[model samples]
Target: MTVSPRNLRALWPLAPCACTALLCLCPALRGRGAEDGAGCGPLLKGSALLLAAGAGPPTLLVRPRSDYVCCHLALAVRLVPALPLGDALYLVPARQALWALDASKPEQRLLAWLRQQAPPDSCHLKCLQILKGLRDLSGRGLEGPLGAQWGRVLSSYALKTALFSVLLRGPWQAWQEQFLVERLEELVLYLRDCLRKRVLMHFFLGNPHVPEAVPVPRFLREAAPLNLLAAFDAATLDAAATQLLAAWSQAPKIIRMYSGPRHLRRSPALCRHVPEASQEAQSD
Candidate 1:
């Protein structure tokens, strides 16, 4: 019988739940050299996060000001436990936010340290934010044809990998020099290349495609190759690519610098064509 993610989450009380699933599904996070039973059979060293936006808790009223709406359920590989789930808990996301609190705390010291060491206001984030917008627009268009569950070709996990790859290629100051339009163009160009090449190497997998400059720590390498884009079993790649190009071509050229609060976001106008879906959560 095929067990859904919801079914798996239902078994959380009986087992380690998401942690166990990660060990079984992702080669990088299974059977390693670490203590046994806290979650996995042993300590898995994989750095990838296999967060899926499943039909889990929807429209969760996290606080008065914010209603925590999960786009999907999450299944983080090695990092969820190592990084502490709280900070990454925003939402499983068909395309949405995540709160870091969702991570487990016991094994997150190193991951937390690395996060602190990253440049707080780096251009990497600036460009990443735009790419995220592009993804949201693309996903919005896909809600119907691909169905709510399988609409997107790219996931937040994949976008972060692409952004980190850019960071690896640079003198950080160089990004600041590029205009916002240039940044978008640069990112879109690279993504288009990845799509064409059919390779978006998992950052933590020690894949042959990972850039040498990226500098993934040895401990984070899971010794298993996990392709981040394996989620799509449909023709979503071509569809998403078409949406991306259209969005890139039609998006307004924002003149504001990456350093400010004044700006207008642009895209292929996914909402312009598709009606918004109801935000109701899946019922058990």
Candidate 2:
């Protein structure tokens, strides 16, 4: 349901869609309070509500033209109402001319990275699957330590960003079958660090490390760094860190539960190669 900014102009005549009223009812909107005036110019907070209210399926129209595309997107969490039993529309409003350019959207960036830089095998797919499996912990007792802020802080996209950051830094060769558990451990630790610092930076915005070949808008590169955790307060961050530390400690066992026998068998041997895992095991 993504459309060009011009398409949004068509809706300008429609009574502003009660974005404020709808947003007030959504707890998800409150987490992004810091994003106002921070680059994306405050998400069209409840625009997704408008789409959900329609008779058909839920449609979220994103205009990916500005620095906003580089930040976190937890659109699924924002849709309060259930829609018709059709596929959720996730359209990217790219013009035909811009198709050749690398997209700034996080999903597009991950896709491009997998095609161009990931190991030429199914290892990257396994890595993604492990991350996806970890997401099951979101609303469970473990994550409850973060209180009401769990949904905002540990969204699936946040985990993806952590993985994206790890891949960008390399040791790319370790993204193999043998290191699956260890890599999962690495990603968990990275997320713990982000929570500790209360700043999960948008991977593409103002990131000098992104490959030059990826066509980032000049404004995004020059814009102030976007902190996805900007709205987190001291208390929320403290609780988040505590919850993640517990997860980090249990990462291997938890991953073993979700992963296959191959990953399970490799865990001990793989821990030897990942320094942090080895140290944690010894301390345990």
Candidate 3:
């Protein structure tokens, strides 16, 4: 259950299988790493610093267009063949100030609990499709001139976590087509409240409401609930709240834009294949 710093190098082989490349998280930023410059400003404006495995002497600075850094991630699988679930726990770099000096101590010094959860139930695919559509539209500037402003404060993970929380508390039948609009409204409202309160708990950690089947680490079970919003500074938080309000007012239009006649015209077969089509287009 514990991986030494020396063996951390073994993880590199596995990285390329999942993503195009692996990037290291900055030891200085710890828990406060953002994908792009967003609101972090000039510090990440030009390049992302990726430290090599050992003593941080030789570093690689990638000048991606986004101007934000990626995080250090170690993948862990909790396989139970008999169960219907396939849970993956990602040991991301921790935020504690103490671990700021070392990136190699992933297992002991810098491990945070993040689970790649399975869908809540059989009904979740429809919910995921709806969520993914909203996200795709938002990236296309449905929420603002660019998604960067809101992206600075609110992450897609936060939104997904919120959606999962709702799914867990569901009556199961509320996910029907007739209640789709209401569900969307509720999800938006829930996110709005999280933005207002500046606290969104990670759905898997320290949650007793989670079913017995989901495997949570013992330390995380005892640890205080994590606030996903904790990374945002006061100014960025205020800006996020303001932008969310503006977006909330335009929610109807945004929803219409996504579920409108343009999308409605697509057959179920085409709709299901959107992810592949979009990926192929992106590659072109």
Candidate 4:
């Protein structure tokens, strides 16, 4: 499958959907196209650049509050089964940013913000790619249910939050040193903790805390300690994780064959431009 990376902003029209804002991987994922103003200081920000940057700009900066600016985008994903995709939220420490007041509209850019933040960090990217590989290994079993069926639970959003929380709580470098299999187990265990608490907080700043300034859906706010992952029981949840691991042991060769290339181990995008990428290419 040779498919170019389509900006999530452009997608075929479908029924509207809502997904929670869960912080995923690292920020370095923003490639050359993205102009990250690390040295710009407070006076100048990337979001502010979005306006002067021109239309169809790769990213738009949304400054909802004074302290930080969230690089916002109109992002939507086309999944196999049709569903309403939601917004994403990201907190960049510096920048004057862009201005927009569509308060009348619902907030749905959390995923977009997440998609942007993830994959740039080598540590977070390393773990996510392996987990995603496991998911692909399991015949795409990772997305348990996007709230379509009874006892429906699990999605990339929740997993991202859990992964972020795990990486934040511990030293990311050491976490990366563990064998690939061990890292995957840690992810499953981390999700178990989120399932236990029934709460998944956004970790854009590398923490499990969600500041009041960040916008969240009414349910996310009112729900309090409980997260969207509260829908499943222990048995089914355990079964899902166990089954995924089992699949790996059941067929190592086949899973590795279908699994993504090592070069993209730290990239969440998963799209490999080349027809075949050897292990040597992965290390580069």
Candidate 5:
């Protein structure tokens, strides 16, 4: 059967999910080190070592390596325990003046340590306040050693924003579909790249407390909030399915190495496109 370019283009949004399914369907074609039972023990061990080094006694006072490592650990921890609840909670503070603390001053170190001890749920708000304070202090030309500290705060906020976008929005869903499939295709590609980067970072540098092997099913379950499957109708889903199948045909072997073989098989029957199916069914 000949599939037209247009037909294939129409199926692109479902590429991520379809690729997932394909991995499940062809177990024998799996690459080396693709064994399903592989443990992430090695990866976790490395992360633990990094964490100990990063969190160990303050040896070099000049660079603030402890601060940087702690921040990354905090980000990693957030990914597993909490869902990005909403955009409002993730917003950066309007005032960036509260972060101005003298690095050399004992009081400043005390303040920073206190802020660090704040509960994770309250960290966002406390961090925002610190940033605003720093920005204001910087304005007055009194920031001194806290300059680098302010930069770290801002960088953390930026990372949080990017992570929030991924968690709250589906990787396959687009801000605009009417313009062309190109934009949506770009989104799929971008999400895939983002996922790859995150996985690699976690694999290489993540904390030891984190699990070594993140099973494909477990990852998908965590990613369910961002899958975009809940948002489509049968017609849209079908179009997505077609695009995904084509995309999978061209996916790199490494990308398909994570999951089991059964994931690739489509349902025995195709879905019907009823725009109101979810709403009507819910009301019934």
Candidate 6:
């Protein structure tokens, strides 16, 4: 059954009800875990604390500190199950690109102001690190109550990232600008694939009680490399990379007919769009 985007939106209202059912059905999906100690509870209590404490926007700009990472890991391990739905801080960094923040303060304000005026870089490695960390932690044999919690946390993060991408790319530029469109499309496909894998992992490893499991075919279709590659222009080696990412995203699970390794080993015939330098390198 094709799940239309409209149908997904329609399902939003039922989220609360679904969560309530999960709680009743799965006893393991309840209570805080070992990470939330006495002092930590009040310190990281609410979203208001982050905003009011002068913490900047919740983005990849924040650096991950030991304490902050510990706090997030705890929340994912503990608070995820009983509530099963809500935003939770996963990681925070100590420093950021000075430009990615408001430079109103006397201390680093000038630095931030200058950085914003500069041209944007292509790869934000800090953001990429956080994404990789999330993927690693979510797959690290975390199960039972903590698994459910981690699942919700990861899924929430994915959704937030998607929304942020949309906001950052805007409708006009997202469609018209080639580079921006490519970046945004890659991000969308990445997050969507992450959500699918995390959800499946949570159900298979963490909670057996989850009634409506996300279908494998649906995820495969959504993460299809060909479909994802369509977002890129007709030519370019990056198209293959896009396809690889899509396939890799679907590789973790045991899908009946898909042979991930075989696809990985066989290279597609180079299209005319391959760069001259790439062709030279391949020939050599």
**lDDT of each candidate versus the true structure:** 0.45, 0.56, 0.47, 0.40, 0.29, 0.32
Model 2, 57-159: lDDT tens digits are 2454433333545444435433422111112112222333111112224456556855676666535556666665544553466534465677667766677
Which candidate do you rate higher for lDDT, 1 or 2? 2
Instruction: Summarize candidate 5's per-residue lDDT along 66-169 as a digit string, tens digits.
Output: 53444243212101111111211111112221111111122233234433443333222322333233233333432433333323322332333332233224
Distance from true position, residue 74, model 6, in Å? 16
Model 6 lDDT per residue over 1-284, tens place: 12333434554564465445433433433345466544333324331222122254222112234554553432221112121122210111112321111101211232243234323542222233334444444446655543444443344333333433333343333333223224333554555454433321221112222223222222322332222122123223233233323333322232112223332222233122334555566468
| Candidate 4: segments with Cα more than 4 A from true spot | 1-121, 139-152, 175-181, 192-223, 248-284
Model 3 scores a TM of 0.46
**RMSD (Cα, Å) of model 5:** 26.3
| Weakest ten-residue segment in model 1 by summed lDDT | 58-67
Give the count of colliding residue pairs in each prediction: 24, 1, 1, 17, 29, 7
Tens-place lDDT per residue, model 1, 1-284, is 02345644543353434444333334544554454534432222222223344455322111111123333433333223111122222112222332221212212342344345455444556666767765665455455554353333566657766765665565555455334455556677677667656667666554555444444445334356656556554355555555666555334432233334332443323223222331121111
- Candidate 2 ranges beyond 4 A from true positions: 1-106, 142-145, 248-258, 269-284
Residue 216, model 3, lDDT = 53
- For candidate 3, write residues 1-284 as lDDT tens digits: 12344654655455443321122233322223385525544444544545444332244443434424343422222211110011223333223211111112222221121122332333344444555555444545434333455653555567767777776667667755545556665676677678778888865456666565545556555656667788666666655655454444334445455455443322322222124555355448
Q: Which one wins on TM-score? A: 2
* Model 5 regions more than 4 Å off: 1-231, 253-284
Best by lDDT: 2
Clashes of 6: 7
List where candidate 1 sits over 4 angstroms from the true fold. 1-55, 58-121, 143-151, 207-220, 231-235, 253-284
TM-scores, all models, native as reference: 0.48, 0.56, 0.46, 0.38, 0.16, 0.21
Give candidate 1's error at residue 98 in angstroms: 19
lDDT over C-alpha atoms for residue 78 of model 4: 22
Question: Which candidate, 3 or 6, would have the higher lDDT against the true structure?
Answer: 3
Candidate 4 lDDT over 1-284, as tens digits, reads 01122423342242232111111221222333336535433434433333224333224333333445553432222211122233332211111232211211122344344334434433455556555555555554344442232123444545565665665455434444334445555675666555555555543323325434446555344432534545556666555554544443423343245344453254332222222343235447
Best of the two (1, 2) by TM-score:
2
The lDDT, on a scale of 0 to 1, for candidate 3 is 0.47
The predicted structure with the larger lDDT, 3 or 5, is: 3
Number of backbone clashes in candidate 2: 1
